[model samples]
Target chain A: MFQGRIIDTKLRKLSIQDAEKFIASSDFGASIFFSGTVRNQNDNKSVIGITYDTHDALVIQSFEEIYNEANEKLEIKNKAVFIDHAKGYLNLGEISIIIAVATKHREEAYKLSRYIIEEIKKRSPIWKKEHYQNSESNWLKGNPLVNEKN
Target chain B: MKVKIELFGATRDFSDQNILELSLNNDSTIEDARIEIIKYLKKNFDGNKDFVRIVNTSAFSSENNNIVSDNYKIKNNEKIAIIPPIGGG
Candidate 1:
């Protein structure tokens, strides 16, 4: 099972409990989940919140590629992958994203979980805007990842 | 030929609209499309060239989703995307 979504709304943060329930029925023995929350500070400034944005069609395509590519490298089998990204705005300490991977073995489960999140960050057509405590919000870099890294 | 340019993240915010359309010469290359889009961004959308990039949507469906160059030729009714540096996790 592969589930990937961009939840674009002004609602409250998502719950990791829901993600665990979604993974509950997995027949695989090993499961690892990762959740990213909004931080209170970044790069020396106080970060109040962040607004995430995405183009869904391309986002979905990127997630599929991440899953397939990870499997090719990691021998992923009987696996379930799910990733949900929060769009709109999120407050500090709010759940911004969730990633859960289930596999027949613990190693593959852990490895794929990391790979999936990294790929989504690296390839997914998603963007973020950081709202500071006192200053105007600043838009973070967009989808051309490597150029920004270099 | 006409091409639709989609914007996401900061690009969408800068442009205000998620999609922009351009009509180009039939023989226009991707380079032409890019110049036209950038011109529109500066003129109408208050967009800054230094903060933006052109991403070929066609290349995304291939094995590698690398951004294509301006030398690539444009197709009729093709849709391209104007992307900024991605910050999502």
Candidate 2:
């Protein structure tokens, strides 16, 4: 059985220690974690905050697709994946997204972690609005990079 | 009649929230609904011309078109989602 959780909350409440402990007791030999933080600068402009928006239904569907793809591509005894994103107002240094993957070996853990993030960025409908310190805000569009594989 | 208007992406930012409910007359069209939204938002945020864009239930729609046809009437509790162009990293 695969476990998935999606939440919108204050980033300060996220317990990294609890996540690490849970993965450790799951009998997994290796674990990988990815955290995306609010950057202070973008395009040489000082960022004040970010507002992330999403078509919630489409986002949830895309997440499920990514989860299934990760399961198919990785070979492991057991796996646990958690993705939490913050909506509304987020300040600098706050964790906007946290992804944790547990596997039986280091190589699979690393590979799966990278793959999941890339796919999420490529396929998800979530969008971000970056607010600069200069009283200007701009929306960061979806991936402009084309997939080399295709 | 009451209709549920769902705002997504940039539209949500413009409205400062995700969902809005509006009461319209029996003859209201999608264009009318949009106009009501535009009027409501202009009271809060300036720059009306640049913010005009639309997304239908399934895909993106133009500013001049009606989201629902005359034959298809929107009743109480019916939902329509409006999506602005998506921007993400």
> Quick one: best TM-score, which candidate?
1
- Cα lDDT tens digits, model 2, A22-134, are 56645677888888888898889899988877655665666667778765666543676666555666888877777787887788888877887777776566678889988
Docking class for candidate 2: incorrect
The segments of candidate 1 whose C-alpha lies over 4 angstroms from its true place after superposition are A142-150, B41-49, B52-78
Model 2 chain A: lowest-lDDT 10 consecutive positions: A141-150
DockQ of 1: 0.44
- Give the per-residue lDDT of model 1 (tens digit) for B1-89: 88777766665654556777899999676567656766776776566545435332222221133455556666788777655556577
**How well does model 2 score by local distance difference test?**
0.62
Per-prediction CA RMSD (Å):
4.0, 7.0
Off by over 4 Å in 2: A1-3, A10-12, A55-58, A74-77, A143-150, B1-3, B13-76, B83-89
Indicate the residue-level lDDT of A65 in model 2: 73
Tens digits of lDDT, candidate 1, A1-150: 788877765755576776777777648899888999999888898999998887677788888888887756877756888888888888888888899888888988889998888878877777888999897898775456433210
True contacts kept of each: 0.62, 0.29
TM per candidate comes to 0.82, 0.67
Which TM-score values does chain B get in all models?
Answer: 0.67, 0.63
